[model samples]
Target: MIVSTNDGQFDQLIDDLSRLPTYTIGRATTNSIVVANGKISGQHARLIQCTPTCFIFEDLSSKNGSFVNEVRIARKVVDKQDTLRLADTTFDIDTLLALLKAEPVKAEKPVPPVSITPKLLSEVESNSLNFTEEFADLKQVYEQYPKLRKDCRNREKMIRTGSVILSSIVSISAVVSTGGAALPLLHVLSGAGLSVLIPTLCSTLLSTEEKLEVIDKEYRERYRCPNPACRDPFGTREWELLAQQKTCRRCQAIWVQ
Candidate 1:
């Protein structure tokens, strides 16, 4: 469906199709799209049909990956009629077609489909993408550790309060016995139940131990080696100092945290 071509011109040519189920832009002659432009790879990228009205633009991991507006994405879900860019090309999906063109692809080795999750709150919009990660060391030093400690205290307080109420019941039932064959037995049973229950409740109601949390926010934003290739965590926090200036233990990235 060679709707348009604008490999090089004053500006890009526009393809106004409503949606496209599947298509690719590549320099390879076998590719559905034959982009002869030198800027694009021989086998660049393609759009996979996820549903009748949904699609995923997948980068084939070329020298330069395809861009949704300007952001580079390995894979991302998109709704019908969305447009994207690869090198100098811009494409509009064609959803109005009754049946999309299908072909059986054979290869030396199979390429796995890229996993892309669509945003439910809003339709996929191009221009930019934001990702979040985590660092537990930063969380423990600055934020969550205080809250976790407070929770431990609250749980201990609840156990103490519950123990006092149960103790009162046990003391009354053990000493103040009503006289009768059933009454004495009932008192004994009540005392015995409390003896087992109070300890059980205190021990198992909630864990009093601190749990280790994992790193999760944007990993690069945390105190770590600034080198994009390194994963070494920045070491040795100065307890008396409040400033963020620090050095990476592995890559020696001397920068403010």
Candidate 2:
């Protein structure tokens, strides 16, 4: 059996769950199934396979909690037929199994060994030009960070605005439904509950933090040393300074044409 989700990073990975009787699911990389969504807790949930087909799913007191087929569950018996949800990501267990079973396995092609030879002058220059091009690409990706950050902020702002508008409408509807017959205290409490609860729930359900994380991950992947051998991550370092240096510190690769 395999455990997987239709979430980022883990989408293409097919990790066998039968290898371990128990498996953890969370945002942390150390988890058996890492889910990078913002709504997922670092140690969100655990799955235990008691038998070949029987499994137990338990929530680790996560903020959002776990749901099986749309019903919130603290602990429940689940199998391949059941669908599991963690935060915004949902996993169709049966679909995953079917996908894996239907996939055709391809045999690995063996690579032939290449004979070592001295680098020619033209080859050396060609590599330098390639590195320069790669460096320029990295700079372009680095420049996109500011816009990505702004987009994340804008999305969060939109969600907040929508939540407020929706919550206000729900509160007004609740109070109007009372037809002014209820006590003043009852009206105040009901309105407060509707407004606060609706917005809070909406905010939790539609968070932009996951999108921000994905942007950061992609930036780090793209903004790195041009040298393939030493792809050292220059975390949040100034791109202008890197360009001025003209060479990679780790690999001493030329970053200029």
Candidate 3:
């Protein structure tokens, strides 16, 4: 049975589900049951005795999230005892059965069995046996302190070089303008001041080894997993853990790091 939140387009949702061939259970039509506030609204659980062996519930992409039992479920199949939450309403198995009670049972033909070829089965087995291990090398690379230190040094050097260039320009201008002057010394004084200021400004602009260390520390702290299932938090050390990891130690949840 397809169920969704009654967000003004109830008729449209019913129409869409009714069009599907799998929806026909006995002679019951789409209008056999009605949905209200995410629940069955008026039916009893005994009605589900006439329900088809298999049923599908589409989310209809409601505004609020959907939950099966207490866990949030993405678009997928559901089973008995699963409680669905749509917006603010909750529909348990009993509620679903109750709603189905109002609909008349219709005769349905048995579905044909699907067959799989030997070639397809072999292909699936072959593909399933192969597992990629690219992330292992990547993890080792990130663990190396030398690479991180070198990166930090390179960044610091670039900033220092820019500072030196700005200071040199200021110093040269000061020397040239003050070559023979004592009275009109303001230009030289200004240039000398600028030379120191420029270097200081460049140094301030560039990130040093100490700053990078701090950034790394903060990143590790933020990304670290306190959960036992996902102990190794630094799965993707690239740019705040961008890579994917097959397993999380603290949570044991496989995900892209």
lDDT of 1 by residue, 1-257 (tens): 11112222101100111122356657877776676678889878876542233445778887867777567777665544456667766655553132233475566786897556676334433311211112223433334223323433343543453344334334323332222112232233222212111221222212333111111111112444434556555444432232343444454443333
Worst 10 residues of 2 by lDDT: 9-18
Name model 2 segments beyond 4 Å from true.
1-102, 108-111, 119-130, 153-206
Q: Residue-wise lDDT of candidate 3 within 1-257, one digit each (tens)?
A: 22223223333222222222222111123434455443322321111110121123444444455566766554433445457665456776455546553457798999998676998888876544222232333333344333333444553453443334333333323322222211122223222211111121122322354334432433343344323334455644562253444544445443433
* Arranged by TM-score, best first: 2, 1, 3
**Stretches > 4 Å off in candidate 1:** 1-24, 95-257
Cα lDDT tens digits for candidate 2, 194-242: 2111111222222355334434545565578868788889889988898
For each candidate in turn, the TM-score is 0.28, 0.38, 0.23
Candidates 1 and 2 compared: the better one by TM-score is 2
**For each candidate, how many residue pairs have backbone atoms clashing (under 3 Å)?**
13, 0, 21
Q: What is candidate 1's TM-score against the reference?
A: 0.28
Cα error, candidate 3, residue 25 (Å): 16
The numbered model that scores best in TM-score is 2
Q: Which model scores highest in lDDT?
A: 2
lDDT of 1: 0.41
